[model samples]
Target: MILADLQSRLRIALTNTLVEEWTLFTPTTGTSRPSARTIAFHLGWYLRQTVERTWSVDSEYDRSGMVLEQAVQFDGDTRHVPDLIVHQRGLLGPEHNLLLAHVSVDEASGPDDVPELSSAQALQRRFGYRYAMLLDLRLHVEGRRASVTPYWQWATLEKGAESPEPVAVYTPRVLAEITERARRAGD
Candidate 1:
């Protein structure tokens, strides 16, 4: 699929996920925010609904049989498990590797924790994915309810692109309205 079409579909799915699964973002029991992996799973579910049945949406799928190269300065394990992926299972080529995404909630310790533009481009080169996305969602926890802040940004790197582009899926006003609805639901 073309980059614009893919991005539009992804935006719809992501917006649906946030609107429908707001409870996941806001925990009734504790103050702790949901993990990125947890949110990705839900996002993947929504993405699956938006795509054709042939497309498989998975979260934290590490067994793609592709190994990522580690940086010389970093001694830690280089196993790069994408938070979300859209592709056909068992097809290892770029044709089948539609999208690769890394998601992070709240504050990331460093670039390693959340892949930035350069790292996203490297992943696209190594994995041969048509697109790479970095989704940064910040949680604003108030008592038992938490809402995703408008500060969230979606950065995307297209195939052979020099740098990643920031795309606004929805207006901050829309996000605020949804957040208010979520907050009301919690009460």
Candidate 2:
């Protein structure tokens, strides 16, 4: 399929998940449940970030490049879509190996990878997330305005675990800043 077509299909899959099974995205443990838009934005942000990292090896596409293969659920069932997936293969069906990927950023870290946060020690050093960014098929959703949705940060995940006990949420203002920069650039 053409790149545009593939992207459209993938988004369709994301929407389908939100409409039919977003409830399944519950923390599986926590009492708080983020909105669908938040989830979508989280997934979208994760995907965009992955493409950026992958672009180092596959220069054919930019950091934001991805074939766009959408679906709900970790297995495209119930109600769960992962945040991101690697766009390795050309525009086609699921990869022979895998497509979806998960990601998380540690807001508490410094540029030097210093131990700004407890999870900093475990991050991929440069781009690795503080928590497990599992690639669930149901990830990736649109948020308020034109932004990626929010993502779930499981307490069991390292980011939360390593964090200083309780009230662990990383709302990176960096994305909003980037969005503003992009908007200004386009303007």
lDDT of 1 by residue, 48-149 (tens): 988888888987565544454575112245444678889888777778788888777767345566655556556666656777776777666667657675
Model 1: residue 62 alpha-carbon error in angstroms: 4.0
Candidate 2, residue 1: lDDT: 22
- lDDT per residue for candidate 2 within 1-187, as digits (tens), equals 2333433443444444333343434333244434434544544543343343432112123233533332311322222223343344444322211233233222222233211223322222222222222212222223422333333222222233322422212135743554454344433
Candidate 2 has an lDDT of 0.32
Whole-model lDDT values for every prediction: 0.68, 0.32
Q: Flag regions of model 2 displaced more than 4 Å.
A: 26-187
RMSD in Å for model 2? 15.6
TM-scores, one per candidate: 0.80, 0.23
